[model samples]
Target: MFYAVIPAGGSGTRLWPLSRAGHPKFLHTLTGTSASLLQATVDRLGALADPASTYVVTGVAHVASVARQLPTLPDANILVEPSPRDSCAAIGLAAAIISLREPSALMGSFAADHLVRDTDAFVEAVRAAMGGAEAGLLMTVGITPTHPETGYGYLRCGDAVGDGPVSRVAEFTEKPPYDVAVSYVESGRYFWNASMFIWRVDVFLGELSRQQPELYAGLMRIAQAWDGPERERVLGEVWCTLPKISVDYAVMEGAAAAGLVGTVPGDFGWNDVGDFNTLGDILERDERGNVVIEAGDGPVSKPQVELLDSERTVVVPRSGRLVSAVGVHDLIIVDTPDALLVCPRNRAQDVKKLVDGLKERGTSYI
Candidate 1:
């Protein structure tokens, strides 16, 4: 069985007011389902990874809440970072620890907040990717593009590497311009980089040592002391010294250049749930195409909202007060105890701008 590592370290600023610094978007159930995104992610991978083999890498601020959400998780499985160093350090640390325990084990590092609707299909894709990883290739599950989505990074796919259901990752491209995204979709050669990666722990650590020598060295030191009494001291000394970089920049892109990277084409329904508009699309809506999300304590099955002639809108009622909207179309209304967010659906991705402004003002609402 493959070992699973979940990196849950983002504050999710795009979905502010509802997603705060202490309580992030992963903690909230954006979907109508009872499980949060983090819980859903763990459950989705349960068929492949047992509780002991699964590890969650999170920040000091979220460790308690993460443990509370996942009662079955072992205490040792929760790896806490001293600070927010980026994805590279978080994932590299997990890889290093897993390597010491079982060098040849297949370690699949998945995001803690991504939504995968078809758990069966996701597991099948991971199994397919495992074949490539077993063959000494770094594997990633590439999501099939549905439209000209410019918000996500794109992966350029090439010819098949081997007989297994995996292809060589030709190139890794960041979010491009509208025309470039359109061309990518029209050419049918690109897949959205959802950041779900699978590979042998030893193989991945070797690649990391090759690409990010300094970062890898630091993580190894921390990992060696992880099980001992010097765990916290080593982590404190080495973590902050490591460079803050993403795995894409530190490893994957370089490995793809060396022809050591492959991917499985995953067409399973996936959603990043980055912003309110994306959440609005996933949730249930009214007859007039208005989605009212009920949040906070108490039995909030139905949202206390009154939408009049509102079409294609999203309303989040989190403050236990009745929210009334009239003739407001394509708008997002999020009401919290201390802050209220009002933005058009087209500007949903720009909600982080408001958070930025509030942060500059040193307000607690952010």
Candidate 2:
């Protein structure tokens, strides 16, 4: 059986103001659609797997929101993390729980906040990964890079693994400098590491046991108590003790070290949609290169009002709000009810610094 595990514990800090503590980025309707990023992820999974086979791994704090957003998903499918441990523990817990029921299940681990344009190509790429997983290979989809993006990690492709659409993983590189990223792209040897992994439950568990023994032991303790009457209580206690390491650092990187998994090319028009700037780039833009999202009430007044000689600038005004820009070129103006973000078009990735400063000030309201 094919199952999907959506990890929804990340607090998309980069898209602040619109993305707050109470409401994460996954819950935001940035695409001008009624559906949220989490709901969109679940919908994407529905196209490939049964709704019954899909699971959402999220923090206990987000349980109610996740449940409210996806009422159709089975209640048991919502795997609640007691605390924000990290992706490694979150995915390990999901694998353990799902494996308890379906030993031979092929589970696909995905981030809950990505923006994918081509659903059909995504499904096809996943099918190829499933085929590779069936052959005992921990398969990860490597996105064909459209640019020399330093924000994402790259996966170097090695030899061809099988006749199917999988290839041996050459190596994994974390986010590198601009020169390295450029060299990787120019060499035509690497793809953006999308972090979308597929493998059998036991295969991942075995790798965890081999590499992260301490984490595996902790997971075993929780797995042993997963079905008990004290399941929730036990989970709460155990979650706080798990380390805050990512799955890539703990497992996938280790798998590459042990020569167990392979990297496969995927061309699904994938974008992680990490920030508001990226969201603008992924969606349609006007002739002025503006991307707007209107929510809450009626259409935003002056949605595309031009000011003094500002060409090729993007202005996104919150509904029921009036926003005007003047003397700005190639800029992004995101005006929300609570906060307004104005930045140069090319410096969108640096918005995270503002979030860091806000966090430092203990402004929990975002």
Candidate 3:
């Protein structure tokens, strides 16, 4: 059986003002649709399996919002993490739960906020990755790089496996420099590390036991308390004690070193949707290259606007607000109810540093 575990806990500080502590980026309807990123992610997985087969691992803070967004999902399927323990623990917990129910089930770990255009191709890629996992290989879907993107990690692929399109992962590089990324794309030897992994429950658990014995022991303790009323209590204890590490650092890297590697080429037009610039790139931009997202109850009035010499810019006006731009070029103007972010287009990625500064100053307005 094929099961999906979506790790929905993420602090999307980069998309601030629109993404806040109470409402994270996954809950934002950046596409101007009624569905949120988390909801869309769940809907995408529903095409591959039943709602019962899909599980959401998230923080306790967002449980209510998640439940409200996805009413079809069962309440029990929502595994609330007591605290943030990073991806390794989140995935390990999901694997442990699936192992208890279906020993032979193949689990796919997905980030809840990624954007993909083609659901059909995503399903196909998942099937290919699952096939490798069923054959006792730790499988990951690597996207064919469209450009020399230094923002994302790259996976060096080895020879083809049998007649399938899947390839053995030669090595994993974490966010290489510009020249190296360009070389990787030019040589046709690397793919963008999408972080989408597929593996059998027992296979991942065995690897965890072999590589991270301490974390495995802690997971075992939490798994043993699954049937008791002390489940949440035990999980809280484990959350505080387990080391904070990503699954790539803890298991996949080690498994690759141990010669158990598999990969599937993912050409599903995937993007992390990390920030507003990426969101603008993904969405349908206006003639002026602007992407606007409006939400909540607000007055709508069209104001006469005239642009003198604005070129190559994106202007997003919040719902119920009148915005008029004049004589602006190569700027991202994001006007929200609480905060307004105006920055050069080239420095859009660095907005996260501004958010970090706000966080350091303990300013909740951001």
* Candidate 3 per-residue C-alpha lDDT over 212-278 given as tens digits, one digit per residue, 9 for 90 to 100: 9999889888977887899978987776899889898899888877767789998888988877777
Greater-TM-score candidate between 1 and 3: 1
Error of 1 at 346 (Å): 0.5
Model 3 error, position 255 (Å): 1.2
Cα RMSD, each candidate:
1.4, 2.0, 2.2
True-structure lDDT of candidate 1: 0.90
C-alpha lDDT (0 to 100) for residue 203 of candidate 1: 87
Give the number of the best model, judged by TM-score.
1
Best-matching candidate per lDDT: 1
lDDT of 2 at 32: 62
Candidate that beats the other on TM-score, 1 or 2, i.e. the better one = 1
What TM-score does candidate 2 get on C-alpha atoms?
A: 0.94
**Comparing 1 and 3 on lDDT, the stronger one:** 1
**lDDT-better candidate, 2 vs 3:** 3
For candidate 3, which ten residues in a row score worst on lDDT? Answer: 296-305
lDDT of each: 0.90, 0.82, 0.82
Where model 3 places Cα greater than 4 Å from the true spot, the runs are: 296-309
Q: Quote the positional error of residue 91 for candidate 1 in Å.
A: 0.5
lDDT of 1 by residue, 1-366 (tens): 689999998888989889999899888877767788899999999999999999999999999999999999999999999999899999999999999998898999999888888899999999999999999989988887888888888889989986778999988888889999999998988999988999998889999999889999999999999999999899989999999999998999989898888999887889999999988888788888888777533476655888888898999888878899889999999998888989998898899998999999998887
TM-scores, each model vs. reference: 0.97, 0.94, 0.94
Candidate 1: residue 214 Cα off by (Å): 0.4
